[model samples]
Target: MAHETFLKEIGGKSVVEQIVDNITNAIINGELKPGDKIPTENELCASMGVGRNSVREAIKILGAYGVINIKRAEGTFVTQDYDSKMLFPVLYGIILQKDSANQIVELRKIIDVGILQLVIEKLDSESLYKVEQAMKDLETKITTFNVKAKDIFEADIAFHMVLVDITQNALLEGICFYVDQITRTSRMKAIEKFLTEDATEQFLLMHKEMLRVLKEKNKNEINKVVENHYQYWEKVNS
Candidate 1:
């Protein structure tokens, strides 16, 4: 249980998973540098004493996640820019764990509200377009159909992500991505439960108010508006 508290269960206890750990460890230990082509599947199979199928599966998984890149005509290489520093923290939901998901939401409130303050301080016209685009996409997704919960969820994530993006902070983006992944269940619940026709309209109004606040660039009221908008989360679940 203690182990489960920290690590996500990847199912079937696949031995292929170890390949990721081994490769990551290699990267961390400086044995494998970014942009360095890794051994071929046959070579990896021989070296790791694993079957080629497992090696290929592990490589595919890492490739899918951008940890590695498989050049079509060339060989697979460590993703030159893969930051191991952010890997584990992001993988485990910024280290807050599933048990502390409420704290994660609280952290989101703090980060997001802080972002609102920054955005209000520096409301670039270019950034406003991105924010408006995300809002439009979110509204479209939520109102579309029963077939697109994922679309609604993604737009929901993107709308707030634009808030942070406007601040131009890379660390905040990573941290928010972590928080978003961790709090996805609560987000989905809030969207499904409270985003009815009337509620979505109300939601749009709240966002419009936030955009207005950003236009006005008033910092003092940033927290109040952010808190008010986020009450939906508190209304449904932590």
Candidate 2:
């Protein structure tokens, strides 16, 4: 019975899935340097004692998430700058099960409001310039295109990322980085349902206001405005 159970666990798992995990761990641990060429399917299969089909499947899976790249006739190579592709699965599960857009928005707002206080006091000219540039780029995109649901959602993320960056806290910045990635797909879907002409106008106005607050170095006002602005998205979801 124990042997049967062990076989069930192993046989139920895809060889490709196992290979992807191994390679991902190696990358995270710095064993597989960026741009390193992974072994060929046959080589990996021989080395791991896994079948060639399993090795190929693993390579394909990694390629799908931008973890690795395969060149025609060249070779499969570990990505030079791969982020965590595995997190997407967890993100997908969270988004699918939570059914609460407002919960995500609320979490973002809480983080951002804290960041705003720091920015009001510490943001330098260059960081302020970066925020303005991101706003301008978003405005340009909105003006040029019909502003697809995806575009609006990305703009929203970009706008907040600028705020996160201004805080100059590496830990906070890293949190926002992955938070953006995890929420992106769901944000796109939410925007598709809730985004409208009025919503765009409101957000653009809020960006302008935020820029003004930064320029004036108004700490209390900055905190108040950021909290209120983000709360709008929560209201929308509600």
Q: For each candidate in the order shown, give its overall lDDT on alpha carbons.
A: 0.72, 0.70
**Winning candidate number (TM-score):** 1
TM-score of every candidate relative to the true structure: 0.58, 0.55
lDDT for each residue of candidate 2 in 1-238, tens digit (9 for 90 to 100): 1111111113455677767777776777676778988777766666566888787877877887778989999998878763556445545665676655666676677777778778888888888888899889777766655668777667777877888877867767765777777667655655554455346666677778888888888766865776757655555566
- Give me the runs in candidate 1 sitting further than 4 Å from their true place: 1-84, 90-99, 145-147, 196-198
Shift in Å, residue 40, candidate 1: 29
TM-score of 1: 0.58
As for candidate 2, its clashing pairs are none
Q: What does each candidate score in C-alpha RMSD?
A: 8.7, 7.8
lDDT (tens digit, per residue) of candidate 1 on 28-139? 7677778888878877776656788888898887877777889998989988763434444355654546546556667777887889888877678888888888878877
